[model samples]
Target: MLDLARIIADELAVKPTQVENALTLFAEGATIPFVARYRKERTGSLDETQLRHISERYDYLTELEDRKKVILETIAQAGKLTEELQAKIEACQQKNELEDLYLPYKPKRRTRATIARERGLEPLADWIKQLNLSKASAALTPEAARYLDPEKGVETVEDALKGAADILAEEIAERTESRAYLRDYFLKQGVFASRIKDDYPEGTTKYEMYRQFSVPVREIAPHNLLALFRGEKEGIINLTLDFDETEVLNYLESREIRTKVPEIRNFYRELIQDGFKRLMQNSLTSEVRSLKKEWADIESIETFEANLRELLLSAPAGMKPTLAIDPGFRTGCKVSVLDETGQFLEYQTIFPHTGDRQKVEAAKTISRLIAQYKIESIAIGNGTAGRETDRFIGDVLKTCDNPPIKVMVNESGASIYSASEVARDEFPDLDLTVRGAISIGRRLQDPLAELVKIDPKSIGVGQYQHDVDQKLLKKKLDDTVESCVNYVGVDLNTASKELLGFVSGLTPTIAKNIIAYRNENGAFKRRKQLLKVAKLGPKTFEQAAGFLRIRGGDNPLDNTAVHPESYAVVEAIAGDLGIPLTEIAKAGDRLKSVQLQKYTSDRVGLPTLRDILKELEKPGRDPRAEFKYATFKEGINEISDLRPGMELEGIVTNVTNFGAFVDIGVHQDGLVHISQLADRFVNDPKEIVKVGQVVKVRVLDVNEQLKRIGLSMRSRDRA
Candidate 1:
């Protein structure tokens, strides 16, 4: 049926040829990052996001095709598959539509219709269904009597008519068009009504707002539906749909009953009402609710993915000798010191929040540790007593001659990482909080590297992450992580096994093997040495080598993003320049003299050559932006310290379907609603802001009772 490539192209607003070539490349096993970066010409310069969309849609269509094959095969085997029915099924573009087309032919258990049919009443029902349209008042009484047989359990005309009505109801409900029209009617015109269950207290819970609530079925926001569904599932509310049935009944009557005969028309009315109520209402309500929930899940998952991507791509403070603290109040703050390369050097505890007496001792201990480790930066986990700890550190640093830059780091999944097997292996003797502190320190040094150790779901950036489709959520988040990792090429000499797992074509086993080989034989001197890693064969090397950077390797090209397959071309240019590969780094101007066209071949094209030349010019450049952070306002340590019109500098901790949550050093994050995100209209907050973005937000309002703070970035002057 459909031209899949052309349909996808139209949806994405890309050329059909680009879609076709990208699909072909995908079928041939090329990864999205590879195709987006290396095959620009083939895809008409489609970027990574576009390529990902194409890939996702391609997978969906492929799965849909497989489903179609299964449906057709099963129907054909059932011996009821017709040419027209096959065409109808083939023409369906959606899973719901395809299933609807297969509904009549699907296997059935013993139901009312089946029981009636087995009792030899099919002819009588057919007679009723075909009542003469021209003459209206045709009596179904005589026809019902003919079907009454004592042997078949049709003991009377009334029993016969009842069975006939059940058969008719099932028939009407099974019609594809009937289901389609009614589903649309419900979606557009129906209302979702939820009332507090009888005998339930009014103010007992957060669901009080939904005690007597009604919203348009089509207009209910994702968050509202999720809350409502939770409420219904918890048995606190009685949820149901309300819609005008007159319109639907009229539509069904016009389609199913053509005859105007008064007697038969009366019976048809009863049949239609029974079908709508008994056969269709429950299933259709479930179907409609499921459809809406799917849309909401999609919205929530996309929000999660976007927030996670921003958090993962957050600016790193670079490799600096640092001290990190996972702050606490009563048990004392866990302190971890790390060297420039993130090697754990020491661990201790300091009672910064104990009192004025212990606070002085804590400051002394921090100063000694800083001096001993020569800490270039201090990272404090933004958890319990985080602001108070920061204040203490700032006061202590004020008394020092050479103070390090102290920063607060989001420790969202630091605990998860600390308790993980990876952490246990690395710091077997240390306490969990100490491992968590080390993770926080490493996170500031290189966020992408440290964040990969924890599952994206536990990263605390997702909204309703636990409630979304786990399989779809995992696939999407995995793709996002892989894309981010490859975009930031890993340093071959210093990358941990966990960091390398996301590299293209590299699995966990291969990652571990590479690290093992590194420890045994030292750093990889060139890209070719990757082949020596056990089980990292030619294909794996081909996919992963370009994304792995080996600084100061034997070949200078090894450090850049240029693939190994194109090393010959790079060497040729270096030879033409009459310089060694190491010296080729400074030979950008001299290399312009060579003809790039001469380098193009069947295997390597102009797009790839252009990338090679670009890499040669700025070899080993980082694609990530320069490191930066938000400076939270002083003295705003808790929600109680907040007030309206107080402008503060904060980092966005999470972005959602409705708004972005900004942490203003107040412990609790404030919501920057979509309407207040920008001066202009803002529908998607991701377009205007991202996680970890340092923003100037003015406080719009604060509800101390609810622990809610509303923030605005629209046309407000920064304080």
Candidate 2:
């Protein structure tokens, strides 16, 4: 634990004490949102982002320790455990390092070297190892012939010698220290070079990215390296680790040959070169390159996860009747209405095909919904018939004598949601088209809530999402969903089973049971009521209850992040003073009088107690609403209407390692490249902006032919 704290402190460049304090809060089951918002003084003002980073690193180190235990046990069982080995294993910081130490003991298939050892050539191989053979023929003899059987493929002294060398090579490859040293040396010194395959046809542009590409191991771009390795693996190209052979031989000779007996030195030199070239070189090169690619993938995924969390937490329209149009042509346009709280109200079919009376009826229906239910916004699906529908809605609004209703394009994954089993259960009576409309309407009201029903990939947020590793993409996207769900507290009473399923530590089965319990019993009146739900055990409750908000519950703390188990502590605090637990909500000054130490326990430590006191101050407060809102030009609807230097409001649709894409009143989002993220240099796109964040950006360049808009957040010019 101390070592873990030290590593985190060193990596984050903070004091061990600071890490210890932060970990204490995290261990006590405090949410990152709570710690960053309320316990600022304890964490040295490390924001939620920093706290989350520390928490993740902490979990990784714990995993490393568990792996170390398994490796140590495996080595012990193999009878190879020594005090030195045990100490090294205990101190190991990474999984790769521990696995490297355990490589020799790891079980493997029988190879050529194992077969040679099984034959009576073991003694002969030992004799060869001791021989100081400057000349190869001096050590060669017919007496070494008894073990040299042509039936087993060893026909002569040369064949036996070659077999002995193969044994030596395998032994060298298995040596933990030798492999480690060689891997590091090569990674630091090796240069990666690739050439187009000879049979790829002359002047092929398929691998133009790697044809002339050469970079030092340290300086190579991860994406480029991954692409090249992928090409090579697919037999589309040939790649090599280029290095001067003489220099490599000299380095190995210096390490292996202490005395310069000419014959012995020559033999060792040839042996080292042969062993490296035949066995270690290519294997180690590929391993190191794989490690580099994995590291890059992790970093990219982490960046993506952070951006996705922010985007999912972006503010929703919050319980307003909204008209969602899934724009289309031959299929006609699908329209649906969501009630004040985003529940599906009604849906209808409308066609605006070039010219149709249905278009006018659609306009009248929208206006009626706006008048009847006070619909604040129209969420048009940013898809096929989007532009034409936008024009239709604009024409309708221009002739209206009512409150100006804002029309916004919705990124509709509604069709996917409607087809899902969850949607089927939610709306069994409705058709797929009606469900899609409801999905679009509800998405505008609360994107996070509606989008959680569909798979994130189907939402179309990334570049080359389908091409990447599916398991990796799903894990990353799931992590993003978990982080987002926890970041924005879930409404215990109103949240759908899909939304609740995304909450940290809660699964779909558990979420459904919770909703079932709610439906059977009533709305969850307190966080403790979750215990009554089937399959929702204590551990699941501990992880999820803090992020669930129960409004108008028996205790005000239930409506906030305050855990149910801490109710006694709050009661005790209230008892210490002349007040009731209910009055503690209004007695902010008196609540602060209670010392956290007085209420400390194994589970409810100072960290947890301190958080409980803060929640008492402001119950049911939303952490996200403090952020700014998105506002675009009233009349600007089409991409062609966008001119260079026009300042307009936009919602960040997706954020990548490269940049954040903003949907500025167009079906296609403009790239606010990492360089244009801010006036200053930005290392990560999430640092300056995030997915779903509303930011004012200026049009820097517009390429109509390419259907691309280059935007910048730096300028303020309105053309």
Candidate 3:
């Protein structure tokens, strides 16, 4: 285990102690968030990503050990378990390396060598391995072929020698040492090369991207490699690894030959070259290339997940009543009003095209709702009738002598969310249209909280999400959600079950039970009160209690991310300093004197203690800072009104692998392609923007017919 920890530390470029500490915490059931946030000092302040990598590597090493055990047992059963072989197996660090060592002894179906062995030619194969080139010419005599059988396909002395050579070739191919040497040589020196098959139809553009491409194994870009392999799998191209055959043959022959006999050297060279070219080269090349591609895909997906998590946790617009409108022509407009806490308050249908009187009535209805609810903002869905509805609402706000209610365009995934089972349960009595409006309003109020209720794919925030591996995408999306939810602590008192379900270590069942208990008993006034909920056991509490916040709890530390189990420790520190926890919250200057090392334990180390001190400095402080207002053009209501180089305020509606979709007071949300994400190269669109981010953009192109408006943030810098 210590050696495994050292290997992991070497791979990750960290101290062995850090890997051991992280593994210990992980083994003790501490989650990534808990270990990352609370055990910083032990791990040298490793972030969540680094800790996850260590955990994953630890699992891989454990699997490697298991494979080693299996290989040793198999070899012992075969009566071939030598001490040298056992030591080699134990020293293997990777799954691939262990498998390579076990390949020769692995059970298999009858092959050419197996057939020869069954034919009683094992003696001849052994003689060939010792290959006496001094008498090579004499050994090929007819009497030397007495064991050869014509029916078994060995016709003469020459045929027998050829058959024995074939057996030798197969044996060499299976040798663990030979395979390892070849694998390492290929990894360090091989080059990937591809070309369109000449036999393919002439002038075909299907494989144009890969018509001629070459890159060393180490230098190939992951995305390009994935694209090339995908094209090849789709039959649009062909790929191969390029290597110097003569050089490889020399390397293999050098290992097999020790004497300076000219005949022996020539024979060995011919044998090794034939074996590699005919049996091993192509197969090994393909296998290695596939493995490299898999590694690249894993890295790419990890990067994508990181970028997505950051985007999902971006700053929200905060809780405030918002007038949501899903505009449409034939069905009129769906409007809803939400209270300051994002609850559905009222709903109304507004039609602007029926006539001027209908338009006036719709305007009056909107004005009344805005006045009645004191709506802080208006959120318009960026769809077919969105521009018309925005214009109508703007005109109404202008005519009224009320506070200027900012009109913001929202993404159109709320309809999908509203029709979902989750939305139905939340608003059972409300119509789908009204629920959709409520979703829009809540999204504008706090995107992170509301968006969590909807499936990320349905939210239309990803590029090629439907085309990617569904299981992989879902796992990544779930991880992103958990990371986001944990990053912004959940309010235990007021958070909905949907939001609570995403909190770290809390399952959907526990989240539902917590809500049920709150409904039956009343609002929880302290962190300890969670224990009263059914199935809210000690283990779950240990994991989740820290992230669940109670704003006005009996103990101020309960409002922070400090766990209840650590209350005694905090009290001790406070007592030693001669101050109360509440007083420390008010003025944390005295906390500087509390020595964290004195409170360290096997479970709660100096790392966790320091975190507690930091939390006490500002209890219940929001990770997201203050919100800022976004400014939109006064009269612009449609994409047609947009001109090149004109700056406009836009809300990011959907973020995808390629780019982000922004609504600029236009009925259609324009795409800001990933290439135009910034002046520098943007690998993912989510890195630079996210869903519901209010960004300033400049119009690059406006297509009225197609309703496509090209937007850019690059010019926003100049403005």
Candidate 4:
């Protein structure tokens, strides 16, 4: 077997030592985020992406080695493992290659070839393969006559020859070289052709775009391929891989036929064609399709991860007294008032859309709540009746002496959160709608914190999220959430268990323990308080201390990302500057001139010292962008209200490979196709836009009947 670390290092373009160190850290129970952030010096400052690549590659290589061992053991038990064969199996780099070499010896279940071998035809097949026909046109029946035995199920020479042909066909199909060549050909030269079923009329099913689609396997987009597979799976379309059969047959014959004898050549030709059509084509087609599907899943999952990361890392509106509203039509709007810390302070029902008298009462209630809570921000859920509710609030605010900043929050997964058990645990007596309102307000305050409680898929920022590999998707999404949560350190005193659970090295049990400790005692006054939590040992503390913040703590550095182990370094710096440790954040000028190399030790290198100095500059500073919101057009409340050539400011709700979907205050979002995403060529939609980005787009067309809105952002297409 190849050196796993060396192979991974070559693949990732990093040093083998870095890969080995990262693997060692992983084996020691360190996470990707922890290793990437804290063990920079040991791994030569490898980032999260490179570390994850190394980790994933290590797992795959380990599994491959285990599979190779099983295959070698099986072959050895069967007395078929030769020196050359053992060498080949040991040197195999891919699982497919190992399986290909093992195909001829793999156990079978009553194949036609197996029946022939059992019926005393194996000797006859061997005779024909070695026969050198002196007469080019000699009939093969004479030679096959010796194998004709009634007791062994071969009744005549013809039956014996047919059985021999079956054996040769299976043998030809199982040839490792032929399989490798054909698999590569199928992937590179095959074309995916899909057509709608006769039962589904043209442009009727949701898969109309794929009704008569044909694309080369290599050039098909990931989303398009996934769509075609889904259509075929749903029985609405017939999908097949089309390739040049004559070319494949020619290649197989050239590889197998080595004689000038026409009779033997003809016999082998017939069996080769039979092997390809009867045995190899279907299996190889499925294998190619499976490979393409895996690739598509990876690309789709990556797109989902990018969008999810952008959504999770979106700017927060900061902690402020907030008024949250879950907009509805007949059910009325559920109103929730939250304090600056996102605690639910009050709840009410306001029927702003009912009668004129009810509207007056709703206006008065909102104004009274604003005055009572001193609401600094108003968060309105962008759901049913959202625009109208925003307009109503706008009217209400017009009369107020000091109006708060009213922003429409995309409450995509608010319903999911409201109905979740976590929400129930937090607010058992509150109505679901009331809980939803609270979620909207909290999301505005801190998106990462609130969104972590809900499933990332339910956040509605992905493409074909439900169709991807659920286990793999969950892992990627969880990793994304964990990375974001740690990137923006969590508040030790007030973070919920869901948010705290994502902290580096913090398990759900430990998060719950931290919450329990805070509840039994008061808020954490120092970062060291976490050591008291049940099951949170020193190792956990070492990994998690830097990413957990405690504001107004006994030590000010606890509020920043500087780890406790590095506290001595900062204290040394403060001592050198002749200043107290509390004033470290204020000594930016002096600290900047201080050589970072002077503070570096064996464990604390330049990379870590620089990070510490940066953290001291902006203690507990958020890495996300500043707060911003799209100002949707006032009158465009529904799809019907939209018109061509109307320029509107919208927020990107989701970014897929094809385009960006922008929410322009209408209930439905409009598509800004990849071609229209920019004036120049845009290879990826993410290159131009991301989730939660406010963009300006002009409406190109609107199909109200289908609820489709076409939009463009190219500067050349200005109205």
- Comparing candidate 1 with candidate 3, which one achieves the higher lDDT? 1
Score residue 585 of candidate 3 by CA lDDT: 76
lDDT by residue for model 2 over 1-719, one digit each (tens)? 23888889898888888788899987786656556644556777776567877988898889988888788888889898999888888888877777878877777788767777765566776666656432343434554665778777778877776666667657666667767877787678778888887677756646776876688787675556667767887788788777666776676666655544565556566777887787778777878877777766666566556655665776676667677788778888877877777777767777776466767777787677667766677777767767677778777777767654554545646678889998889989988877887787776677788888888777766544543566787877886786677766899888998899887668889998988999999887878888889998887787787789987788777777776666777788888887877777898787777877877776566766776777788876666654344555656767788899888888887777778889877667899988888877888677887676788888999898769999988745322
TM-scores, each model vs. reference: 0.95, 0.81, 0.83, 0.98
Using TM-score, give the best candidate's number: 4
For model 2 the local lDDT of residue 608 reads 66
Give the poorly placed runs of model 3, Cα more than 4 Å off.
12-18, 39-46, 132-144, 157-159, 177-217, 232-274, 353-358, 383-392, 400-416, 429-433, 457-476, 569-584, 588-610, 625-719
RMSD of 2: 5.1
Overall local distance difference test of candidate 4: 0.92
Minimal lDDT window, size 10, model 4: 130-139
Candidate 1: where is the Cα deviation over 4 Å?
1-10, 13-21, 132-137, 577-579, 588-595, 716-719
Name the TM-score of candidate 3: 0.83
So what's the TM-score on candidate 2? 0.81
Which 10 consecutive positions of candidate 1 have the poorest summed lDDT?
129-138
Model 4 lDDT tens row, 461-560: 8888777788999999999999999999999998999999999999999999999999999999998888899999999998899999999989999999
Error of 4 at 69 (Å): 0.6
Q: Mind giving the per-residue lDDT tens digits that candidate 1 earns over 1-719?
A: 67889889999998999999999988877888888877777898899899988888888887888899999999999998999999998877788888888888888898898999999888888878767344545677887898888998999999999899989889999999999999999999999999988768878877998999999999988888888888888889889988888998998888888777777788888989989889888888899999998998989888988888888888789899999999999999999999998999988899988888998899999999989989889999998889988898999999888999999999999999999999998899999999999999999999999999999998899987876789989988999899999988999889989989999889999999999999999988999999999999887888888999988877788899999888998888788779988788798677667688988887788888888888888888877788887777788899999889888999999988789999899888899998889888877888999898999999999999889999999886432
Error of 4 at 136 (Å): 8.5
The lowest-lDDT stretch of 10 consecutive residues in candidate 2 is 132-141
- For candidate 1, the TM-score is 0.95
**Best model per lDDT:** 4
